[model samples]
Each structure stands twice: as C-alpha cells, then as structure tokens.
Target: MKKGLFIFCFTMFIAFASKAQDNTSLPAKYQEKMTSIFNKIPEVTSSAATSLIDFAKSMLGKPYVYASSNPDRGFDCSGFVSYVFSNFGFKVPRSSREFAGAGTPVKLADAKVGDVLIFTGTNPRVRKIGHVGIIYSIENGEIKFIHSTSGKAHGVTVTEFNDYYKSRFMKAVSIVE
Candidate 1:
C-alpha cells in the first residue's frame, strides 16, 4: 500500500511539473497569447487633463448604450469620451476607432491623463481599434482608465489595464496637449 501511494504521488508531481513547464515555456500556439498576456505618464499635464478625467469619472455607473452620445441617456465608449472632452472644449472623433488617428500618437509608456487608449477587439484577427478609454492615472506600474463598457461591468467604470487589456492594446493618443 505504501509503495502504491508513493508511485501515485510521484506521477501526480510529474504531471503538475510538466504542466507548469508548459505554461512557462508557452508553445507556438500560445506565443501570441503569451505576448498579449505579458504586455504609464507626465506633468504640465495639469489641470485640463485632470478636469477631463474627473468629469469622466463622475459619469461612472451611467448606462452604456450603443451609438448614444448623451451622458444622461447613456453612452458608448467613444461617445462617453466625446461627451466628456467636448464639455472641456475639445472636439473629438465620434467613434473609438476614429480616435486612433485623431491626436498625436504617444507611446503607451508616455501616456497621461486625458490620453485616449485604443484597443483591438477580443478576436485575434480583428486589428482595428474597437474600444477606447481615457487615462486616469498610472500607479505602481498599473495604468488605470475610465470608459463605458458593454462588458460584465456594463457601464462607465475605472479599470486597471491588465493582461487582458495588454493583449488588445493598440495605441495611445494624446488629446489634452
């Protein structure tokens, strides 16, 4: 009985070890997946950007509706950003994808509050910028932003730009300056 148990435990250990190795050394099928999973701001970068971010944050909990730009009626991702920035006196593109080309392109590491963060859709083949968010802050190496999502949260909310987002990240556009 003791010998049998030892063999069983050894087999289990080998199985788990191999699984861990697989994860650490992601195979070809997971190379893109790993890149997405593995994959910041400035100052004078002051009041205007801060105000815009604050305004967007204020709209948190508002419903997310497709193609609507009115805050009270609810807003889609781009609409929410458009509405907020318009209130602050900047004209912006009406769609998330359009914003990809609207402002000066900034490296992801150089993003600041009020910058637009563009992302591709969840599908690997979809390369278009399908979502947008306004940068709020970067803290402890985590970039957080505000946007209205049709996602599980289903409304305007602040979210950490984590691994899932990294996978979809397309570009960052600086609109405040």
Candidate 2:
C-alpha cells in the first residue's frame, strides 16, 4: 500500500508538472508552486470523480465553439460541462443558467472533483450564470477547473480559481456523489 501510494503521488506530480509547463499564462514561479502543492494532495479515493476528471482532461486543446457541444466541432463553456457530465451518464443542465438549480450545492471551500462550477458572464456586473467548468482538483485550498473558454487560451484548459474567477464565481454543484 505504501509503494502504491508513493507511485500514485509521483505520477500525479509528473502529470501536474507537464501541465504546468504547457500553461504559459501563469508565471514560472506560480506554476512551480502549483506543481509542488499538487504533489502533496492526498490520494483521491473516489474512482468516479477520477474518471470524470480524466475524461475532461482528455478534451484539453479542443477549440471553444459558441453554442455547440460536439467534441469534433468544439464546445462553449456550458457545452463543455454538459458534454462531460452527459458522457458520464449524468443528466445535467444543457445551459449555464439552467445549472443554477441543478445538483446539490456544495460550498466553494468544500468542493471536490467532478463538481460543476458556475460563474457569471465575462462582465461580472451582469450577475448571471454564463460560464461553467468542472473542478479538476483542489489542493492546498486552491481550486483548479477544466473548461472550454474563449479567453486568451481559447480552448479547453485547466485554470486556477484566481481573483478574476472569484469575482465571477456563482456557486459549485456536485453532479456525482
């Protein structure tokens, strides 16, 4: 069991390191810090959540297409979340706004992998659900999410829940218990 745990932790570290390298938006120092924190996370015991996150990661680099859910054609923010949950046999809201009332609400601090995170539109002043993503991981009290974004990256990517997102963050909901 000890060996297995070590291997898992090591593999996770390598994976995070590679992802951090790919993400150029964050400064070198921030990437290194995030990778270090990822290494210290306890082994995730939920197979279902792991599977969902893995699947979501597989879509990284896919383009962000507005009002579309097809992987081949790409997906918008809500479309990406909808497609991921639907692929896992979960009935989820198709639109971002619809997700406001879907699933059981989970506090931001207590959110886990596979939970859907809703956020307001680009203009946070609107105060309405217009974007969504899946919690990719939570380590050292920091949350990273996977979503199809039209921002700088312009594709499916994992993003840290930083100040920009915090201002737009509406709530998080658990789809897989």
Q: What is model 2's C-alpha RMSD?
A: 11.4
Misplaced by over 4 Å in model 2 are 1-45
lDDT of 2 by residue, 1-177 (tens): 999999999799778766765555878778777766655554444878999999999999999999999999999998999999999899998899999999999998888988999999999888988999999988889999999999999999999999999999999999898
Q: Who wins the lDDT comparison?
A: 2
Candidate 1 clashing pairs, residues 3+ apart or interchain: none
What is candidate 2's TM-score against the reference? Answer: 0.75
Deviation in Å, model 2, residue 56 alpha carbon:
0.5
Off by over 4 Å in 1: 1-45
